[model samples]
Target: MKYTFYLKKTLSFFLFIPFLFFSCKKECKLSPAECHVYENSGSDCTKTKEKNAPVVASLKEIIHPISGSDPTLNMEELSAIGDYIGSAYFVGLGEATHGTREFFQMKDRLFRYLVQNHGFKVMGFEATWGGALYVNQYVLQGIGTAKKTVRKMKFWTWETEEVIALVEWMRAYNLAHPDEEPLQFYGFDMQSVDEEYFWIKDYLSDLDLDLFNSIDTLLKPYVSVADYQTYPSLSETRKNKFKADLVKAKKLFENKESNLVALSSQQEYDLIHQAFVIFIQNEDILDPKFGKGRDFYMARNSEWIRNYVQPRTKVALWAHNGHVTKGDFWAEGAELYEAHAGNYKVIGFSFSKGSFQAYQPKGVGLTTNNVVEEMDCQTVNALMADVGEDNYYIIFDELESTSAAYKYFHKKNPFFMLGSVFYPDSQNTFISLVNLPEHYDILIYFKESHFAKPY
Candidate 1:
């Protein structure tokens, strides 16, 4: 019962996200106090713009235009930036906000380009490993429908029409390119272990009662691996025991012990076993001794994709800007960068002003509101807005030589951050000091943004 605008392309996968669940409400306006990140009067960092004026003026010249929603609109522009993708095992398409439509569209388009043009064969997400197994089967093979596979996921952000269209496109591309490398979907998160948990049970239900009982015995101690919700705090000793048991249980089928099982099926079971341990390890957040946090596990999962899961050397990663950027501030990205040496390249996202989906003190969808307030005069968003471009991409390498881009290179400064929450406490949401060019190899900016359509 809602009217949303949409367009269909030739062999295209673009679709407008439906906004059926919410009604328009009062326009959420912002005050001067909400814009500034600090108590200092110098929150208006516009004065520093004089030194960066030359780079600002050339913004339109250097940036690749990403106007409109069809990410494939301009092939020449997307191709021109291939050098930025470089010779890396991983090419990351990071978003500024998980709740922005443009972010999803452009990242999808970019990854699609990689699958079609580059030798990149794997498309990984920051989604649950268990959920992605179902999605992976559907996208690579024809096991299930696009909508159904995505709907089965625990994460709400990805359960949208846009994602469905992307998966469908991947399916068609896979069918068409049988001789060439097929497109595969993989998740590199410790989100949940239920799909793997249940799949193991059902898979062994027919063949080996001993294995089923073994898996059951391994799982009986825990309540629910699927929910991962509010479980009792586990001691390191208990965590280690579960980790060892899951590994031993998975090897029962793998390691050539069960020659009757398919290699693919065995591989899946083995991966699930390892991923389950990762899920348990990540539950601890960060390690007390080594400082190995969730990001470390995330980075390790990326390595697993290349080494164990996928045979391809080149892959496309989709996640938030924070997880992809290589720096000490973010453990996952830092670990990925360090693991790859100079082989890894990340593209980061930012927005000028527009409504985006985010949470408040508690639960609520994007709701109808212009939460995408104007940028702080002193921040990076304000600087890019001064460039007067609708949408574009700039190579950080080109700007690294300039003395004027010094502030961004040397020190941390205010940057746009619209996480899942951006209202009431919009002032307290995703405002972190970051060295943009340092954090990302390439930067994509939009003059305005719209909220991501929720399922």
Candidate 2:
């Protein structure tokens, strides 16, 4: 009995020994400078700063500070950082406001550098599949009345003077290079009903026609015959009802509008958008397959880069900074690098300090002069004054943060839904308004704050 008790005690001691060993181990919390030195140069924590060494700023300083400024670098230093970057993604918050001259100048310089040194390919502002198709059409054929019609109706911001300039540049590039495919620009967005469904007749076969007709019949009763005949602009009540019904149908279908039976009329517009999503998600349904959305499109783009763009290609993805920002919805933060499979080195361009603040353009009774007043910040007026009016740009800021400022703005102006849809998750990940991921990259407080930026 004594021997057995001793053996049991020894076993307990062995088990406890491992636990104590692990418990006693200390985790070293290194400063950013120490982390940088250790990671980059294999330096120990006791080492002093070297002469002419790179200055390392703390992550806190970068995230929260009086002014989050870029490193003060001369042309040589700028060139060194530029050289380190292989491909760059520029996300414009909105259209250039009057006071953001410095921002634009830097962006322009970056563009020129990518073109001159990196052999960069430019992707433009079209976000829908049809818009991308139209761009390709324009590349093949010069701008004509057809192009203008598509631009006016389908494309949102193409009407902007700045975007027009970019389009003109693309046209000139195409004209100059009659043989080479003008720097490939394709939209990675889903098709909208108003833009592409009417054109389906041109692309669909007899089988597709039958399927579409069958779906239309299934969905016909949900939309009243009178709703079909009513002109969209006839009355506010009629328009609202039409939109409400569509929203209802969208909800009923579990956000799968396309899976439902289709019907004719403006009321059936929501169904069309749904069908597009379904079609893309299930590409096997189409006889001649084409992928849609960023997931498939970016995958294809990656292949294009590997094959054609690999040896010597620098590409600039001119997209919303929201998409490129660290915490953006599609590919931002650590997930972004993981999503890309580390094939492309991605850097986001953001406005460090400017007059730009995101507010709802629609629904709000806002003009260029009153935008700053609508925001939560008290220093907005001063910031606007500091930036000046001539060089600024206005961009549609998508505020995804769930802070007091965001909540206050949304609560006061509930009509400004800001293009978001809420759904419950098993993890209860989205607990409150704050649970949503922030959409903007870097808010460029533009020098002047009034210009209307792009979405």
The C-alpha TM-scores of every prediction are: 0.82, 0.44
Off by over 4 Å in 1: 1-55, 58-61, 223-229, 232-291, 362-370, 406-410, 426-428
Predicted candidate 2 versus true structure: per-residue lDDT over 154-201, tens digit per residue: 544333334444454556665686555345444544323333443332
Clashing pairs in 1: 45-378, 295-332, 354-372, 358-420, 358-421, 359-420, 359-421
lDDT of each: 0.64, 0.33
| lDDT string, candidate 1, 1-455, tens digits | 00001011111321233432221223324343343222223453555677568757656556666665565576666775676676677887788877778888888788777766677777788887667767777776677788777766667668665677778888888788766656777778765666556655554665567767866776645425323344435566765665556556556555544443452244444554554555455444422343356666778777777765445557778888888888665556778787776778888888887766554454654453435455666677778887877888878676545545543545677786765555543454456788777788888888877776665
Top candidate when judged by TM-score against the true structure: 1
RMSD of each: 6.9, 23.6
